[model samples]
Target: MSYGPLPKRIDPRKLAEREVRFESSVDVDQLPRLVECLALPDGKIEVDLQFSVDEQRIRTIVGSARGDLHMACQRCLEPVEVEVAATFNLAIAASEEAAKQLPRYYDPLIVEDEEIELLPVLEEELILSLPMVPYHQDCSIQTSFGDDAGAVDADGAESASEKPNPFSVLAKLKGQ
Candidate 1:
């Protein structure tokens, strides 16, 4: 089936009763906020969502979103490809007030008009899941200061003469 634009507004009540399932792909360009951080935002994001009612008769949305984004590495300022993914279990609340009482396990999704926009929701989750500073898992930058100044010596050895004898302080205190 041709997956077109994902639904903007989702009616939680009907979706919960019918236990609807949704699977779609959205182009990277469609999510403007997410694109701003990317060095290359050329791929499509996959979204898989399911709507159902819980044992407490509360409407819920359970889903995951996944995609790859090229972000500037904070350390090297080079393009570093990273995976952005989020798995969410959310309770659909009728009002902003109702959302406050939601349990910690379920993040509250407030629906003022009884409908929620899917695009922003998905975009937000992916954005929040991203690292604050995107960088390679194993970055190869040199990280050290000199022994006399910052890190150990070039020979990876610190001579005994370099270290102040611990007993020297005690000798001074004794005035001997």
Candidate 2:
């Protein structure tokens, strides 16, 4: 389904009371923190959020955000497109003490005001979803030297086979 642009701020409590579901796209440029993790400033995050009061009377927001982000590949140091997706189950709390009381399954979202900045929340989710080390599946970079197992040294000794085994010393010590 077609989605509109996500609002910059929202009254999550009010939305939860009304049981609102937001389906929208957030611009990449608007999320500064998330942009810092990307190689290029391009792409939009598609988000689907549902706000409601659960059976326990806890106000919560459940949602998923997904997008393709351009990041430098760790293996090749080139731009690679990585798919970032995250799902959040957040329980709204008025204070730190209230947040501490939330169930373990729900992440606490502390808010003291009528409205909260929505982009930062979405940006944080996306940032957490990013891979620690972005790399291509089939990177073109080769990771081997000219060393061969059968090579001999200048003294006519098979260097590879003549290497001392550190474990052998341990075995000798164990025999004592």
Model 2 is weakest, by summed lDDT over 10 consecutive residues, at 147-156
Best by TM-score: 2
Number of clashing residue pairs in every model? Answer: 4, 0
What are the per-residue Cα lDDT tens digits for candidate 1 across 57-83?
A: 888989999988899986667889988
N/CA/C clash count, model 2: 0
Q: Compared with the true structure, what per-residue lDDT tens digits does model 2 show for residues 8-92?
A: 7899998898898889987788889888888998998889999999999999999999999899997788999999999999999
RMSD of each: 4.8, 6.2
Quality of model 2 by C-alpha lDDT: 0.87
